[model samples]
Target: MTALLRAAAGLIIWAIVFASLYALQGLACALGWDKWQIAEASLARLVLLAVYTSGIGVLALLCWRYRPRVSRRQFLDRLAFAGAAAGLFSLIYTGLPVVAASICR
Candidate 1:
């Protein structure tokens, strides 16, 4: 069970971050967060940026933490590391639109 969880943790975190960001984006748009300015940027943009940055940071951490060590040549460890790398790539690819595109529209 532990080994399976370790292998799947990265993908699981990716799903969670993806869903949370989607929900938060909707909420921000509905609440007119774009009208609220923070540091010359809309509150919605800043909030999304913050969450996106944190998600990236967390995925990076997981990648580092689960990296296969020279001594521990375990298949599960390698899988976990690969999962984290894939998750990081996916998160960046999917979330870039939020940063570059209009929030309300």
Candidate 2:
């Protein structure tokens, strides 16, 4: 894929991950998966956290890879940077609530 398209891929994946995690949270609560604990975290919360972390890592790598090319390829660099920003924002906005709130109630 083209660099810009590949950069956009990260944003697209972030959107899917955001939606899936939100739905999964609801489903987990309904099915009592939220109450299923692993260590100090509920199963649902832990799963969400893992997904969020991995997403950020991937996006960050993309950003880093494209960063040096900013002066050479403006469009691709901007797309990659934007994708990273979107990923970070979505993960923080959607994932932080799970940590601050009770998973099931």
Candidate 3:
């Protein structure tokens, strides 16, 4: 149903975001931008963290803006809320490693 698809929109977007960022980190490392300096960190790592943080912010705003509608709509509509949570979790999961690992190695 359209409602279900709508509810799933966040998760779908998160999936794409996750995949794209994951691939981009890999590609950046392969291209040696991982070792390129930005400020105190490598360009690739900074980029990864910045992007992941931005994704979290966007998801948070979307959820907050839609919370009323999601809560007032059918119970099934709460799937959007869940999707937002999952998206946040995935973004954090993907970004955490960047903090611990050397970008180029």
Candidate 4:
């Protein structure tokens, strides 16, 4: 497969997997919460988001390892690229949350 197609597939699968994990984790936390422990607490929400996002990073790395396009020469290069992509995505994804935290503080 071409690099573009591979990237797109990787991204699509990553998105779906992450979204499901996020939903399940959030739901589990909500279900386990006591009446006084609101699901919307800032720190709790942060924990969920952090876990969800880190899960995505780890999944992406695993995907990188299994990618068929990788050659021995290209292995480290591809892994580095995928890691950079994940890092960039995380930075952008959390931008709004960081800004909101700053404004609310």
Query: Which one wins on TM-score?
Result: 1
What is the C-alpha local distance difference test score of each model? 0.90, 0.73, 0.74, 0.51
Q: Write candidate 4's Cα lDDT for 7-101 as tens digits.
A: 45445555665565446445645665322244545444555556556655665675656444635446544654565466446544643443244
TM-score of each: 0.96, 0.77, 0.81, 0.35
Which residue pairs in candidate 1 have backbone atoms (N, alpha carbon, C) closer than 3 angstroms, thus clashing?
Answer: none
Q: Write the per-residue lDDT of candidate 1 for residues 1-105, one digit (tens) a residue.
A: 898898888888888889988998999999999999988999999999999899999999999998879987888889989999999999999899778999889
- Arranged by TM-score with the best first, the candidates are 1, 3, 2, 4
User: What shift in Å separates residue 68 of candidate 1 from its native position after superposition?
Assistant: 2.3
Name the candidate, 3 or 4, with the larger lDDT value. 3
Model 2's alpha-carbon lDDT is 0.73
Over 4 Å off in model 3, which ranges? 68-73
For TM-score, candidate 1 versus 3, the one ahead is: 1
How far residue 86's Cα lies from its native spot in candidate 2, in Å, is 3.0
**Candidate 1 runs further than 4 Å off:** none
User: How well is each residue in 1-105 modelled by candidate 2, as lDDT tens digits?
Assistant: 677676686678678778877887888888888778799778888887777777777767766765545257666667777777777676667767766877667
Question: Which RMSD values do the candidates have, in order?
Answer: 0.8, 2.3, 2.2, 7.1
Q: What's model 4's TM-score?
A: 0.35
Assess the local accuracy of residue 22 in candidate 4 as a C-alpha lDDT between 0 and 100. 49
